[model samples]
Target: MGGLIFWKLRGSDEKPVASVQPPPPATTPQVFEQPPPPPPPPPPPEEDAGKKPAGKVVGVGGGGCAGECKGTAGATLQSALAAKAGAARGCYERGLRQNATLQGKLVISVRVGPGGQVCSAGVASNALGDPGVASCVVGLFRSASFPAPEGGCVDTQVPMNFVPKGGGK
Candidate 1:
């Protein structure tokens, strides 16, 4: 009875269908180069139109270190961040691919351990509006190594400004 049921289910002359498979992906990836950005537009004609611009007084101000660091620690930390600026810019450029007018300031708070290793880092303030970009920049700072501080752990703020090409926004 089981054999008869199997024969009936197998059907009297139906052909078995073959399954189709998709082709494999390419071994090498393709890369496309981006064109250079255009030059900035000329500045608007003198607003005052023949009147000498009034001179303004500028004042310089700064406060003491925010952490136990002293001496050239701040400068050293800034220099280290500058070294990674290009990478951070790359992150912003990736975001610009999504939003052409994306532009803002990201204040990164970084804490460096005694061995010149980054203990913790995060975006203290992110006006860029792109969480992915902010996270990428923070990851870069977190993996970076700054100059050891004179005292113990050093905490500092690194401000990075991202402006799209041609200064859109």
Candidate 2:
């Protein structure tokens, strides 16, 4: 019974002790801190950068700038007519806009230069609503002429409209 009691005393750890040594200091887990976020991107340059150019793009589509080509000193009547015809063909085909077809005539006014390039062009539709046709017509105008038109003028009536079985604006 004495031996058993001694063994029990040595084996036991839950019982209170008369003289107790302080427990080792507790250790806490290390923490990690996150880095700061990156800076934002810069903005784009403005359209009118203050020192204004002579003109801006009012309206444009399909190709180059409208008044980009400076009309040369003079242009021939033949060249003007040729320009008109070619423009007409392209306009006719492209006139087939979405879900609709149209037909009509218009007057195409162009200011040409001696170099045969079209300085500027305008279309007065005899019949309206074929936007595609007008676009195609203008597409023909771009880069088509060589020498510019003569100072006087060349005005002609052109059929600027949509046609049979194609599309609408």
Top candidate on lDDT is 1
Top model by TM-score, which number? Answer: 1
In candidate 2 the C-alpha lDDT for residue 100 amounts to 44
lDDT (10s digit) by residue, model 1, range 1-169? 9999999988867887898888897688767888889999876668543232121101111212223544335567667777786679999989989988889998888766555667578889999889999999988987777776545556778888888777744
Q: What TM-score do all the candidates reach, one by one?
A: 0.55, 0.42
Clashes of 2: 25
Per-residue alpha-carbon lDDT of candidate 2 for residues 1-169, written as tens digits (9 for 90 to 100):
9999989988886777699789998898888777777777555446455322223222222222333443233335555566566557555655544534356565565655333445466676546456666666765665466443443223333444435544433
Provide the lDDT at 164 for model 1. 74
Every candidate's lDDT: 0.71, 0.51
How much is the lDDT of residue 119 in candidate 2?
Answer: 49
